[model samples]
Target: MGWARQKQQHHNAAFFWRYLLMASALCLVFFTPLCRAGAENHRNAYATMMYMGTPRDYEFYVAIRVLLKSLAALHVDADLVVIASVDVPARWVRALEKEDGAKVVRVENMDNPYKKQANFDKRFKLTLNKLYAWSLVDYDRVVMLDADNLFLRKTDELFQCGQFCAVFINPCIFHTGLFVLQPSMTVFKDMVHELEIGRENADGADQGFISSYFPELLGQPLFHPPANGTRLEGTYRLPLGYQMDASYYYLKLRWSIPCGPNSVITFPGAPWLKPWYWWSWPVLPLGIQWHEVRRQTLGYSSEMAVVLIQCAIYIGIIGMTRLARPSLSKLCYRRSDKSTYLVQNCLKLVAFWCILAAYIAPFFTIPHTVHPLLGWSLYLLGSFALCSIAVNAFLLPILPVLVPWFGIIGVLLVMAFPWYRDGVVRALCVFAYSFCCAPFLSAAVSKIMVALQLTFEREAFLPRLGESNPPSGFNKLY
Candidate 1:
């Protein structure tokens, strides 16, 4: 009887062990995947917006691409989202999704109800589209950004912020250039309703509308992401370090913000100076930094071909003009005083137009979104080549014709002077340089006029303005 009882106890113990093992396997098969799905559903995303119809739509396209590619390079453990307007071209949409790895959220452009606001800028009409970020309910947290925000590091901890948070680059008003928000369909609907009602928007743009919506954000304590990996709830004021205005560094020539991670730099100032314009640099020294990120990512290849083609065209103009110089001079003729005067006035008018063209032509040909050095270089080259044509076509002095070219190079040097203690000093130096150049510029203008006048006196007009023999001194024009 003792042997039978012991064997029965052992059999029961083995059965219990087997049941426990089977239950554990079931949990692994079911519960682990659920946990993963929960984590994914609570995913974070870095989002920015792009709308069409603006004069700078393509520029912003490139800017958004750079921002997305830069974030990808940081290897942030979050999705990249572009809240692109529906009007954005299909090819651009495909590029953003396939090449840049951004999830493009096509949205309709939100009309600004506050368009009548006295200080509204028309360019920001569609910035209201940024409010669509709140409708991205699939993302637990979204750091909605402006394309000008330059990230210095992975700010995944921004995901830890509550429903809404933004950096106050100004004391009273928080900048909308970069902000953290929790996605909520309810909040998005309310924002849309507010837009319909024409809420008190100071700037008639997203910055004003959003700032008014979260007016109390200024009172919230600065957020500090808990070390235990817990996300916070409710509105908060992000430290200034998160959206450190690029202007702050200009005064000190360095970043000195003592709070939070100085992870992103925002250019909330002038639209033309927003880093990617190439001409924005030296003025905004941080532009080069933006370009560096672009160099590593999207690159200038999109515009490089245009630039190369332009350069080729300019070079051809110069070469062909130089070779055709003699033949062009042969077209000169002699005639009566009245006819000569009429011809002279016509030539002067044409020469003035050509000189103006020399200065303005490069503005259209060179890519507007290139590096400052490259942009300025192309401008100077284009100007020189075009000016050379005017010199060969009209009997003008070379030095006076090239004076504007020298002035541009000089202005660039002054603006690019690296030793200025602050922006004020830099501005003063530029002013002084310009003041000094005014006299030289005036003299060059006088010289150019005199040269034009002499051309008509020396190279006489034909009976019909193109029939007379070339003058004895006509060769000097070349």
Candidate 2:
């Protein structure tokens, strides 16, 4: 009996050693970079696609600038980096660079071969651009944000969290909008590998990909330390306060600590109904706050300057094109004909005029300026109100479709003259919206709308693009 027991003990000891060896190797693999960069600068930034010169991209750009200001407001001033696409407008890129504490890091759009091979354009809505977070190695840690998020208070303590820490958004997932991460090329490459192997999440973007990558993550409890008493290389759950949604604004007063921070308020409403939807504020919660953010980050004068420059450049481009190829005038401006549908032309004309006005009004603040507000407000609210009475009582099912259609089509139509005009400008604007902004917003809005009906979806937003200065004509604003 003693001999048999001794043999069994020896076998158990060997197994324990093997497990220890593996665990140690993992620690070395993951924690080495974290240790080396422990004293380096950390960053807080977001990713947003900017191509189409659309108002949405402008708003997000302003949001990033404001976010950096908010960080400085809390005295947690660190490097503010914006990872953007290669062809984003020079104006937008320069505007970001001009911000007091912001830097724009341009990156190429990384494609998911699996999504393309599967012909899953609609299904593959989440951006692969966010994978660049792994490559932001200059900073020891990074707090990646969705440009739409508003910081209610200081959140500097987030840096104290582990390599991968996020809030448990649902029973099965964690919020990505505001998370603490120690950027690692190793982890980033692993994500790319997963994508190459056709392992994608149902929701498409980073959240699902991240959740799937760290399956054991859901088990980690929030507001509690890990079993080992320190943050390890693996995934972790952050406190609820780190990433709260709009619902938290009222609910948090009761549960959140009286003076805690980040209490990061995520605007997870329908994409079009954002707080700063200048024309309309559907939720009636913080529409004013949204505008206030715009006001803070992009001053009235700066915004005006940007608009005037755009108008001048565009007018010049149109003039130059017509002069260069007289025949192109026919394509640039269509003759008024009875065949033109009244409704379509009216809306298109209204949009065209509105773009002109949006650029012009910043130059001269006139009483009639309020007319555009009234008109646009009527349009957006009327549309939302009319749709509110749809057959289903929950929410407009087509809200998702309309939001994206507006951005995609709106962008294309703005430069409808096609190659006859500034094709470089048009391509950049469209790509930013289609590849980056529109896709992310559509998916988020679709998810958020459903969550509102079922459960308010708490998730993160990632900015995924790169950019350099645009051409000389339109680079005056910054």
Candidate 3:
């Protein structure tokens, strides 16, 4: 009788396991079509690029119209969706609406915060309004382009890429500028909710909100294209033209190069005053005449020298701080018995000199204009060095304190359940390496370089002073 009972129990367990496996298979089969259908409905059959701005801004209108004309030339066959928030005179909106392939969407919810001129806050409100307008559109693939952006080449190939979400590599953060989204009203609503939450939490700018939710909204469908001009391989795509950030151009000089034919120039923030408007003519390479034409027509290049100078100053400060840490530490020890005023003064002076040197390096190398290769090299090298130092100085010191705790957690997770050991162990390893080891390793390298005095020299390798200047025909104002 006991043997018979044991056999019955074994049969029951086997039956349960078989039932579970069949159920899992059935669920996968059932949802496969639904998932595929959702993706298909949002695929890039009809592409639309949305620009939200007030029509009353004449310069912005001119920039948008020129961009539309360029897109038309490209034979994109995609609709240009422009959302006008302000009370654009009926005539102006009508004129743009009458354009053959352009769709002017008027958003009534946009509030004019300032009674006089629109400011950053108003722009944010306008963006939200435009986002709402996008929700109403029935397009499959939607891209949000800043009005300052001028398309120099055809972007139909971008839609040809079989990705649901595509974005240009955002140079500052590990993100992108021109994002190709699978348009859905639900996703748009979720984005608005997240933005509202960000505003309430004081998390960051709107872009921050968007970036934070990017992983969730796109759900592993998100892709970052390669550096402009690279051939697409293994799902990696590039933008049509170089998408420029006005702030990066003016402040960082990171996007001054016309990397390839399909590069689109994008200017974040105010659209009217762009560095490219001034520097595009003289600096543009001979083969890239289309960019020059776009710059001439739109009157902005998304490049600026002042911003580049500021970026250099920032890099210099970071470099000097890293370089002077040892000296400062010694000074503190020597002055322990006395007032620390002398040491403080000396440190401040060092910082000031470093910043001044950094600021002036660009001027001495390339003054009055911008050079793509020289500018990008300085920006990249300086940023890399600064990041290396930052990691070493800040992150390395905390590793020893955290490593044991991380190891213990890893062991606990692994021992807690043998069935989930593989995934948990892999996750813990990634967390431990990323949070604990990477920073220390980077910092150690930076410290070693500093000790050897193998510092990066900005002026020696970059473009020499007066290499390029603003275009002769460029207007100071839009």
Q: Write the per-residue lDDT of candidate 2 for residues 154-252, one digit (tens) a residue.
A: 665566566777776465677667677888899888887888877957566666677777777667645444445453455567766666666544332
Q: Note the residue pairs that clash in candidate 1.
A: 333-460
**How far in Å is the alpha carbon of 63 misplaced in model 2?**
2.2
Which run of 10 residues does model 2 get worst, by summed lDDT?
456-465
Give the Cα RMSD of candidate 1.
7.6
Please write out the lDDT profile of model 3 over residues 1-478, one tens digit for every residue: 9999999999999999999999999989999999866643442332222334543355455556666666666666466666665466676677566753567666565332222322244434444453453364476555656555656566655554332343444543323345555556787777666555443312233344455554443334333344463323323334324454343433322344444353575655433234333223222222133344554443233345655675677577667757664322211122221233344344434543443343334433332223333344454444444443433332223233233334434443433333333444545544664566556545644553343222211211111223343233322322
| Cα-based lDDT at residue 308, candidate 1 | 91
Q: Tell me model 2's lDDT, rounded to 2 decimals.
A: 0.54
Each model's TM-score, in the order given? Answer: 0.84, 0.51, 0.40
How does model 2 score by TM-score?
A: 0.51
**Model 2, position 355: C-alpha lDDT score:** 36
